[model samples]
Target: MPGFTKHMYLNDLNKIKSDFSNYIKNIIQILSEEYNLDSIMYILEKYYPYECQILNEKYDYYCLKDKKLIPLNKKVRYLMPKPKSIIRGLKITKKILSKTYKDNYALNFDKNLQLENEELLKKEREPKINKIKEKIDKAKLKAQEVEPSFLDELMGLYERKRTTQKDKVYIFKELEKYYCLKVISFF
Candidate 1:
């Protein structure tokens, strides 16, 4: 009997089902449960001399054959014809020309170029004029508004009390104590 190797039997079980006879299928199925259909197909197409034969017009009426599978059709080699290039013997060349003259052509070409620069300078000076106007407006507003005296508020917080001598002495003692504590903590 034609026997398959362990690796072959394990990997080509599905191929045997599709390509081989009932005897070969049963033998492969009984020999191993693990089979990779894609790897087996790849091996058959790439390594082995496999053949497919159409028995009838129907798609189902087909047979596959190899050394492991049932023999069916004659060996037919299919070759893809070499592709022909349409643009054969074509050469591409690029030439970049640079002006050799040293004279400034841009100034000669545009008469209004100096006028454009003058306009641009005028436009640049507009922001400075606007800034001066804004400063004058701010000065005018400040002149109209009354300013609050922060010094007056600070002086009021430290103003002396018109109390009796005993009360004044007690207040001065408390102030001295608070200042001493603050200075010690700061150090």
Candidate 2:
């Protein structure tokens, strides 16, 4: 409590998980049936912000890893306590003078401790990183595949002649004319 006073006794400030990414698979299910592109984009946008926040927090945590974060005292001496205990009506000064209480001191950053802690943190982050990667890879595979419905016929035409964009457009136009049908250009 003396060292880490933020939010009372909290030590680590790292966020455990992304606020929005937990339901991305469900979001995808409700979107495109084939590519699920809308869901994929949702995951990307939400995941990126969470990644950035995590990176920022990690940066701040290691910012002073190699530098001194607390100043060391030139001499150790306890300032006499003057306040009276509320219930006992007696001075609460003995603890400060105790050897055990006085032994605590701050110093330059400990590189060994930092490395040990960093290794442990990497272990904690590994599974989350792997899970996100798997999710993104799955989304990539879905986005790359052809959609069904009307797109299947369109893609069938597209697949027959896998040529350059210009050639494909020309070929499709030629097919349109040969079939005596008007081709609508979505572009």
Candidate 3:
């Protein structure tokens, strides 16, 4: 722990957080479906006490993949000693070096690790880029087909025919008949 005194320890904080995560996972497994935030808090209080935040932040474990923390009929049935022992071990070390504990070291480590993991995930997701591009191209083609320009020209021609054809030569023949009838009545 000397080389990892505090500042130097931060260099590989991500690894430490990963280790802690594994440790938490293992602890949860031992408890089975018998684990609850309240009970876990009690154990932490009885042992390490300082890491009680783990119990208080139940939301952190709400989506836990570990079987131990999973609920069964709203009940937790098993209790184990590994987590208490782990917490106790850390508590002793943390108390001795309270001033130099630098909890932020762990926090910073977790942050960096998460960022690195995200970068890895982003790389894994790189292939989807092509799929998105293909979708965009398809959409553009569909939009162009939705409104063909020739329809507008056809519509204009139909409108002109309807309005002007009404006053065309066919109407003149009817008017001539009306005039002849009017002359016969006058005679």
Q: Which segments of candidate 2 are over 4 A away from where they belong?
A: 1-50, 53-106, 145-187
Tens-place lDDT digits, model 3, residues 81-146? 243343444533234224443343333345455556546544543455556558757755644323
Q: For candidate 1, which ten residues in a row score worst on lDDT?
A: 88-97
Model 1 C-alpha RMSD to native? 43.5
Task: Estimate the overall C-alpha local distance difference test score of candidate 2.
Answer: 0.39
List where candidate 3 sits over 4 angstroms from the true fold: 1-109, 142-187
**Residue by residue across 1-187, what tens digits does model 2's lDDT show?**
5444333212232122222233232232222223223334443344344554543444444343323333453232222121111101212223322354334312333556645654654565567777888986775564424333454365466666566788678656644432211222221
Q: Give the runs in model 1 whose Cα sits over 4 Å from its true position.
A: 1-111, 145-187
Task: Estimate TM-scores for all models.
Answer: 0.18, 0.25, 0.20
Model 3 clashing residue pairs (backbone): 32-68, 34-76, 34-77, 34-78
Please list the C-alpha lDDT of all candidates, in the order they appear.
0.32, 0.39, 0.39
Ranked candidates, highest TM-score first: 2, 3, 1
Score residue 106 of candidate 2 by CA lDDT: 21
Q: lDDT tens string, model 1, 26-120?
A: 22211112223333333233222222111111112122122214344534221111111101111110000112211223224343654564355
Which pairs of residues collide in model 2? none
Between 1 and 3, whose TM-score is larger?
Answer: 3
Query: Which has the better TM-score: candidate 2, or candidate 3?
Result: 2
